[model samples]
Target: MEAVMSLLVGCFFAAGVYLMLSKAIIRILIGIVLFGNAVNLLIFTAGRITREAPPVIAPDMDRLTGIAANPLPQALILTAIVISFSFFAFLLVLALRTYQELGSDNTVQMRVAEPEGDTLPPLGY
Candidate 1:
């Protein structure tokens, strides 16, 4: 189980990194979201997977056969999810603005928009 969890985390991280390094804004946005998810998952996995019982305890129950899950990871994940959502929303707006300004979603075209040749004003002037 631990090995599988490690593999899953590794896969998510690799995919997120790949997407993040892409030139396309949409891919980048997705990458950021994936990265956040990966981090949350990794943290959760680190804490260890526990029982199926509800996190809250009933006073009557004397003992639980299985170990209880660490609540910190759950809380961290919830916080991360909310933060990631806000980040995704912001990225979407940023991407939309970028597309609007560039007139196309191609990053290469944007790169070429800058003057490359003898198009600059004199340095002193």
Candidate 2:
């Protein structure tokens, strides 16, 4: 199971990176989302998935008698989900605005900051 999950994690990361390298804004946004999910899965796998009891100690026992699921990874993944969602939303809005203003989502064409021209800027003052 762990091996399968590990392979999935790698695939997600690779696909995310490939999408991110594209010139389209939408693809980049999707890549970001995929990358975030991959990270979350990685954290979950690292925490170790086992059918164990909750991390609670009985009154008769000084310590947990059996394996207990680690709570830290769950907490971290929860927080990451919230943060990543907000980030993705912001990026999506920003991309939409860029497309509206520039009339293009292609990175090659959206050169508002530096218009395409054959002439070069004057050198050193």
**Candidate with best TM-score:** 2
Name the 10 consecutive residues with the lowest summed lDDT in model 1: 109-118
Pairs that clash in candidate 1:
none
What residue pairs clash in candidate 2, if any at all? none
Q: lDDT for each of the candidates?
A: 0.82, 0.94
lDDT string for model 1 (1-125, tens) is: 87898898899899999998987878888888878888988988887887666566668876665656678888888998998899899889988998988786767667655745647777894
Model 2, CA-based lDDT: 0.94
The per-candidate count of clashes, in order, stands at: 0, 0
lDDT of 2 at 75: 97
The digit string of per-residue lDDT tens for model 2 on 15-122 reads 999999999999999999999999999999999988888898899889987779899999999999999999999999999999999999999998766888756788
